[model samples]
Target: MKNIFTIVLLFATLSFYGQDKKISFLDLVGNNIQVPRGCEAQSVYELQACNGTSIKWDYYSTDMLNEVFNATISAFAEGNSSKTEVTFTSFGGQLKGYKFKMGTTFQYFLMGTIKDQPLMINLGTPKDITKSDDLDGFLSLFFDEVG
Candidate 1:
């Protein structure tokens, strides 16, 4: 009985260590974000947030915040009746932005400034996330903040 218990414990320890660990990755543009175990960033602008999700980031002058925001709203609203604002508090901070369903997938846009530069991070996922709670979880999984 003691030998069997020891073997089970050892197996459990090894299994835990063998699994891929989810990591918090800081983007090349100085944004602190999160990615799943298998995803790796290819550049500052485009990255895979996970195996099936895509993330795109861009930077602009702080002065362009309103311009960019309005442009984004108009762009998403064009031909898409589901475009709406989504605001939630995640692990990083309070994120207020827009969300729209493009085709069968959903995309979330978060706009903020870090160190005086306008930062826009877009997260695209296949999940149908329509509630504030779901939006919070989705943002928490991909974005922290631009630090």
Candidate 2:
């Protein structure tokens, strides 16, 4: 009976630790975005109000999709003093992100159509992504479009 109780406790602990560590934040446009847990929402007028130690985001919108995206990426790189090249990745379908290093940390500037409207988001993280799978996992949080 003690062994069975121990096994059950172990299983419960593992299950609790394996749970997803994320919280949802709705953008001004009503699109639900999943941010890392512990992000605190700031005051109005800030699209990227949700701020946390591990991750933060800034959201934008533009009428010209490609042109605006290119200019935004270039401006961000220049502003961050990042001389590195920007790497692009398609998050399946119309969703895509431009990964680059800003200062000492890595950032992903995502651009895609949300509800037929053009949307751009810059996801900033403090940790350096060393593995491809880790980067993928981070980017995957923004994969699904929800309201």
Candidate 3:
């Protein structure tokens, strides 16, 4: 009886631990850009376009928690359309930019603006997203800008 009780307790602990663990990217995009439960999406204002010899990028974390996570990118407006490049410092190193695109949809195209430049847009796709995940999945989607 004691052995059975011990085994049950062990299983319960493991189960709880597993539940605490966050979900992966694959889970989020498995069924499409369905905003996961307990998660919400927000939009930013128009993105500024610039085409010059150099541009800057900025990074910031909007949310951080098991419940929700969000981030935004912003840039200075140069004109109607600008050719710019952006480099991401977080999550290893990635450089992205936009060329000859209208600034109206730049908000949706890029993850947001950084240092007044647009980051590489995700186009809403995860490499190994999965369903049934929680905030982590949503966060990953946000990072990837999988709108």
Candidate 4:
């Protein structure tokens, strides 16, 4: 009886741990831009590029989606001083970002709404920025949202 109980407990533990531990934010982008270096995954969903760039996927479950989007846009826009690249809204969804020329490298802050979810991606020469992505090709490999 004791042996059977132990086996049951072990099984239960493994079952619990076996649950898929993945959160996705990649549904936020449209397509993937092939970068030269490559990428390193910090977690199943989070990614780091070989070029000192890091990408973060943040998800908020709230009906007040616009509030979150506005807040994020305000935050990124407040600090930009170097230069502005382009700001536009289209099918890829609205995006506003900046690019800075640091010597020979290009630093950028690309933030916007991806699939109506708040999305922010930062990148540079793997030396300045901490986060980074591609849209279509990266989805299957990176963002697999498990219910």
Best by lDDT: 1
The local distance difference test score of model 4 is 0.49
Tens digits of lDDT, candidate 2, 1-147 = 999999999999999999974335635345455444555444221224233223333345555666777887788667565444333333332546566675666676667655556666566666454444544543445443311
Sliding window of 10 residues with minimal summed lDDT for model 4: 126-135
Worst 10 residues of 1 by lDDT: 138-147
lDDT of 4 by residue, 16-121 (tens): 9999754333333554434323555555335666444455555454444446545654665565555655343323555566656566665555555667766544
Question: How many clashes would you count in candidate 3?
Answer: 15
* Cα lDDT, all candidates: 0.66, 0.52, 0.33, 0.49
Candidate ranking under TM-score, highest first, comes to 1, 2, 4, 3
Off by over 4 Å in 2: 1-24, 28-37, 43-63, 79-93, 128-132, 135-140, 144-147
TM-score of each: 0.60, 0.47, 0.23, 0.43
TM-score of 2: 0.47
Off by over 4 Å in 3: 18-96, 99-119, 124-147
Candidate 2, run of 10 with poorest lDDT: 44-53
Question: Ranking under lDDT, best-scoring first?
Answer: 1, 2, 4, 3
| CA error at residue 39 for candidate 3, angstroms | 10
For residue 77, model 1's alpha carbon misses the true position, in angstroms, by 1.4
